[model samples]
Target: MKKLLLLVGGSAGLGEALYSHYKNLDYDIVEFSRSGQQPEHVFLDMSRKETAIDTIDLQFAQLAKQPWQEIVLIINAAQIGPIGELAMSEPKQWWQNIEVNLTLPISIMGRFQTHFQAVEAPKNIAFVSSGAATSVIEGWSLYSATKAGVEHFIRVVAQEQSSKSNPITPVILNPGIMDTQMQATIRSSSEAQFSNVDWFKQAHETGQLASPATVAGNIAAVLSGKLEAGQVYDVSG
Candidate 1:
């Protein structure tokens, strides 16, 4: 029996960490991202929604031909952009953020479900979510909104699969504040652009941020076990 992991946004941060962890466990890893250079990595640019969805469709079609004991998907790619308030954010970047963080993932999920509907494998999916889904962070309107949209969409997907005997179990994983390049970008933002900039800076200075590897390990534990459909799992520092 073989196990496969279809990891989106597997180029950096928690995605990279998960890639390494699962690789060590001997799972076939098909990483999708623009930057990942692994032999199994499929180059995917989330900015181009139509092209990205096409690529994902092709990949899932190929994946459907394989026999597997388990298949897992972890969508960790996101755009933490349009950091400033809505009025001050650039239109092009704001739309790009929506494409990457919302539409693209949703499209990918739909394709995966349709393609693998008949596969009787233990299919699991975990969507990385955020506290921003529930918090109102100033100057983070676009980022916050996209996170909330994705999280709800995840629950909806789970709800749709709940009645299936071999359902594609989907869960929301909230990886709390972490020390990542994304956080670096947040810390570099001026107070005018991000009201909570100082808080991120202080977190970095005080070493309060969780390591990506640690968070990835916690997430792996959840994915490797039996998951309650539509449950929300929070991994904190």
Candidate 2:
């Protein structure tokens, strides 16, 4: 049975790299993105509840019939908006951030759990959490809270699954800092608030920031059983 690697949010940085790498592998590669160009890919907007659930159900139906040995979900869809104190920030923007970061991952995992529980295969879920989950930085309350919530959710799920008859390994990962579009968006939005924007740009210009390919390789390694399950791996090199 060919292993199935289902990559969510494949149009962006880390997700894009994961798709590119796994598509060339012997295993079957399926991807979902808002604007995916690859074959066997579907367009999915994770922010919309109905759309997200419908897309996931369609994908699950297809996968359940296949001779797949494993399922890997990479939740990499994120929005980086203007930074400001929570009191000064727009309430809608904060809600949007929570929807994308926290709610989407929870929904994805719920779908995965429902689908994989019946399958007699080893199922693993890898959540692409952020360093902001633990570190406190000004003007990042929304991002930080959402990420931290995701990590805690994954941890609790892992604990519950450990005692189940059929178990799924859920890993909460912090991929560290990378030179991705999210970072670029953050730097571009309200540069005055993010005083280190210029420094980050300089790092990217000088090739100091890690490439998406590098981060993707680390993620693939984890999925390949090279890394321990249920432990957070920081992909900082």
Candidate 3:
């Protein structure tokens, strides 16, 4: 059976790029989006546990009916909000960020862990983390913290799998800064507060930012065992 690489955020940006690259490959490419436009892909709203789990369950149930070799979970779903100090930030926004960024991935992984384990084949799970995971950006506390938490969660999961003698390999990867809608959101919001907004905009316009295709290619390489497990690779540098 051919291995299955499932990308969880196919509606936009990195997830979309990954989906496009893998769609034509010999492996099966399944995507999950919040919107139902991609009828072929799973529709999931990670912010809501009920929606997220239901979508995931449906996908897994379908996969169970198919002859799949492995399962790969690409947790690329994220949302970036206004930049501000934690004390001054809106509590609701902070909670939303945490739910989307940190909690959702954990929940999805927990729900699917057993399903992946039951398979008599190798399994790989990768998290689309960020450079913000390691570096502290002044106004990106919520985003940065959530990313870091994800990386830590990946490491712990990997450790637990190893202890259990499971064949699952988990990795946390940083795709770096890309020319995507999220960057635009930052630039737009930073106009009043950040002097580097123009520089960022120029980078985006001039193709200085990493392309999602390139990131997806690197991820594909990782999936092919070109990259080692438990090591984080920065897609930019």
The best candidate by lDDT is: 1
Misplaced by over 4 Å in model 1 are: none
Provide the overall lDDT of each model, using Cα atoms, as 2-decimal numbers.
Answer: 0.89, 0.78, 0.77
Give RMSD (Å) of candidate 2 vs. truth. 1.8
- Candidate 1 residue-wise lDDT, 168-213, digit = tens: 9888899999988899888889888998899899989999999999
Model 2 Cα shift for residue 223 (angstroms)? 1.8
Residue 193 C-alpha lDDT in model 3: 49
lDDT of 2 by residue, 1-237 (tens): 778887878886888888888876765877877898888788888667678888888788778777677767777777655476767677887777778888887988898888777777778888888887898877777888888998888888888888878788888777777878887776675655665667767777887778888888888877777534567887654
Tell me the TM-score of each prediction against the true structure.
0.97, 0.92, 0.90
Best by TM-score: 1
Candidate 3 residue 96 C-alpha distance from true site, Å: 1.1
Question: What is candidate 3's lDDT per residue for 71-149, written digit by digit as tens?
Answer: 6778788887757566756788788898889888887787667566667667788888888788867778888898898
Q: Name the Cα RMSD for model 1.
A: 1.0
Evaluate model 2: give its lDDT.
0.78
Candidate 2, superposed: residue stretches over 4 Å from native: 226-229
